[model samples]
Target: MPKKKKITPKQETALRCLQQNFDKRAELAPSSDDVHATISKSSPVDIDVDADELEKNIATLSINNGNTRIRYILCLDIEATFDGDKSFSHETHEVIELPCILADIKEGKIIDEFHTFVKPSLHPQLTNECIALTGITQVDVDNAPTFREAIQLLDGFMKKHSDKLHPPPQIGSPPPNGWPNLGPRNYVWVTDGHADIERFLCLRSCRINRVRLPAYISGGYIDMKLLFKTHFKERGFRRLPDMLAKWGLSFEGREHSGLQDARQVARIMLFMVQMEAVQLKCNRSIVMEMNLSFAARQL
Candidate 1:
């Protein structure tokens, strides 16, 4: 057997953070401004620790000066198909499947999942290759909702969960929800990779006749694959199964199916959270880094 690589001190610290659940993760994030108070409640120091030292400790690992608020993460995935053409351009292909699961970052579980098959507008007929490749039957396409209808369903699903996360003064008719509230909301949308989003926008753009994609669609989503790549110092884009396997996780469910793929993305993410991989959100998605070697060089 090959020798295992030795874990470093930073990695050990990261591991400790995971063992403690996400409390440490929360300490470093922007939302927990009163981190010292919170941690004091969880694990009290026996000796009289100086207030300055406690503040110093919190400041060292903290992501910011403590301002922004992070709440939830929306893990999602998409599936698309192409006519038998080998050189199919994503520019031409449409979204045939879309699925998403809203995961509670603190609670550590999926609150809800949404998926819908989208009937193609241009091609309309699935090539034999498409059928075999995705295991999506022609009947699935024929009876499924249109791409526009899928968007409506997605909007509805987001509204449902958004209200659950932050309940309204009163629930009536879904009331156009608070997604547009430009302040740093505690929730973010995540995907296995970026191409899925690109394809989704491609199809949606065509339907909207070049109108701007919704802000929720454009800036709202994070490509989780990028997060993993940054964490492990990985180069180049990879398929979901390959990324999962690299992290010693087997695929959770059906590979190509959108919902299953989304679920797998969610599970792997939870695994990362468990491993104490730190996520810092400055503006876009949280950038998780493993700087074990870099920190060692500093010492």
Candidate 2:
């Protein structure tokens, strides 16, 4: 095994602050209703915690601040080929773009990114609708690696950042039963919705490409849309742009561009954590059976 990487002093301070806040929050509140109160009092800032400006300021804090303790959130968003129809099946679609933003939990900013365009074996040609919606051209996919190759590159990126990750389970240990049973993980994947992981990666891409979905990916992920809805107690938003509009923020780039979407999702997640003190956790996981069928569990 490789030696663990050393964390910077700033990172150490941020991790300590986060651990203290989480511990205090757990001690102060036994119910969800009192969480905000606990967070407000436990915040490192000495101002009105409810103020939006304060929350934004907290987001910029780099050195101030998990079991199953998260050090990073891997924000991923995929753009796939579509016929411009809502009734399309996952079986018929193929991921054309893969992008990820690795956000440091304590720093509240993206520390790194991984991106690639995937050439689909099933549908090598992009439909006009898909091209228009995603702005991904045929040349992009033609010049890109295959799904398997792209995933291999992604795995390498994750390994490069392994020092920031939580230790994996022992080789002989029983597979994780649930969130509580699972030991500490340094990071968790976050997506705008379950489709990216559930329908795209697990159900479609892996099966189509004869690739085994990495355990790190299939283990679980956070559905950011669901988290936001539950946290704000509002269900009015239907898409990422809508979510941004609610916060008086506009989408920064092309709507369906994978990297841009992932960045926006990271932004929203940071805002929720720094401003609202919402604890991010894995809310979804895949259960793979002997027969290879997948059952997505909502945790």
Candidate 3:
């Protein structure tokens, strides 16, 4: 047998942290009822879906992925304002709601969540069509944070979980499976589609607000839609509800509501990993090349 590799001090610390977290998962894991209650209390609108049904579906879909390499997944979704039917452009629209769920892939549970509504700088007033579609009222945006402030808060949230979010470097070669050993960097961002990062976060919001996009946010992401199509050998992009239906699961909360949508995406991810044994990886990315000196001058 090959000699065992020695763990460095840094790796030892990370291992200790992981062990402690796992030990406390029993205390940290919230019951399905508690989760539903929390969402209901936090959301502005009432959810009409049956809580028992939703819990049952989640329980049915939750399966252990013994082959999963990653430790965590960050499921993200955004709701934005738009023009009725004229056209679609990231530049024209604005992100109105930002939400994300952090999940422990092996345990198949959402450990934490973050959410906020963003007030549009350009289009301060909500279009009637946008209101009807997203169910976000003018009053909601009025009380929300600006895009810059929202991004800052998001960055802080990521920092708060830095150990999990940014894993330490691996000291040796990757495993024989041809997949890189992610070391402490053991998480990937998951989204229903690419628009959340490519169009909204990187292109529109950061540019309009004159904020430098966080490196982690732009690094890369797993496009769940693409993964589903590839893994199941399906064609074309499907909506979140449709995707959930594939697993006999109904969406739990208000459609298009950022937090609800994010949670649903997390559920789909769990199903894919647990039921289908899909290995999650970054399927899409955006290349952001910025001239820091010039950018600093402009700022």
Candidate 4:
């Protein structure tokens, strides 16, 4: 087995601050220059907590913070193909394969991730082009879990993992001053269409039969493609990658890879929330602030 590296205190501190900011962003708390400055200037505390313990602590802190409301936005992305013939039947534009990724976003940060490959039960074979493009083979699909099973596993994972951490309050909860916190938090789903979500919902409904997820998960999915088109027309940006570059943040790694793409989008969302808060000079605890180790990237 390979040696596991240890995390330093500096990295832990920075991660804590990141998580705090994410929570605050979820609640639309005003940006705090004081928090930013404090994080920037503070030296890392030399503590000896294990990385796993540190992460649990941070999650606890995020759940307990009452200063800013927080929410967990679960996002999924799917893979599909475009037929050369648009005038053909609807089935002609069918999806050859699919992969799903789930990201738990609090405030503006992605705090957790889940991913899985799905075999289309109805479509066992892939076109040669599809196989070449996605690198998914007919054997791969045949051996993979069915769409319904895949989503059920994902749902179970989401509930299990998310429940392990304390969840932030529902968005729009009354502030300490008793005022209704306002603003839409955009649960941006980067996908080809609503198929993934539809499948997820259908699977979830089948499992619970009647119990429904909260409205946050139930309604208003932000489609990146639509957002891109609108941005181009109104702001002259053509794509997500273009938008991120313009904002001075780069989406690293391959574009179409499911988990990588979800992680990239999650980061972009967090950055946007911070920028928005900073621009407005809002001082709310949009992020849970803490410090841990430099070595544990997960922490």
**Candidate topping lDDT:** 2
Instruction: State each model's CA lDDT, in order.
Output: 0.51, 0.64, 0.62, 0.38
RMSD of 2: 17.7
What digit string (tens of lDDT, one per residue) describes model 3 on residues 63-163? 12334357788888998878886677555678898887888878766788777778898889989988998888998889777776676556655765877
lDDT score for residue 260 of model 2: 79
lDDT tens readout by residue for model 4, 162-241? 44323322321122332122233322234433443443332322222222222123223444444434433544434446
Q: Which TM-score value belongs to model 1?
A: 0.64
RMSDs, each prediction? 16.0, 17.7, 16.4, 18.2
lDDT (C-alpha) at residue 42 in model 4: 19
Candidate 1 lDDT over residue span 1-299, tens digit each: 12223566775564444335433332332221221122212121111221111111222222232464445666767667676677766555677877766666566656566667777777678888888877788888787766655555655555556565432111111123322233334555667765565545443323433222223433334567777777777787667777666544456557777777877776667656645454634223221111100010000
* Per-candidate clashes, comma-separated: 2, 5, 2, 19
Candidate 3 vs candidate 4, lDDT winner: 3
Off by over 4 Å in 2: 1-68, 168-182, 288-291
lDDT of 2 by residue, 1-299 (tens): 12223555664555455445433432432221221122221112111122122112221111111224567888999998877777876666888888877878677666777778888988899988889989999998997777766766666667668778664421111233422233346677889888887788767776777665554565556889888789767756558777655545567678888977887888777756765568877777654332335667677
Checking candidate 1 for backbone clashes, the offending pairs are 71-186, 72-186
Candidate 3 vs. true structure, TM-score = 0.69
**Could you give me the TM-score of model 4 versus the true structure?**
0.49
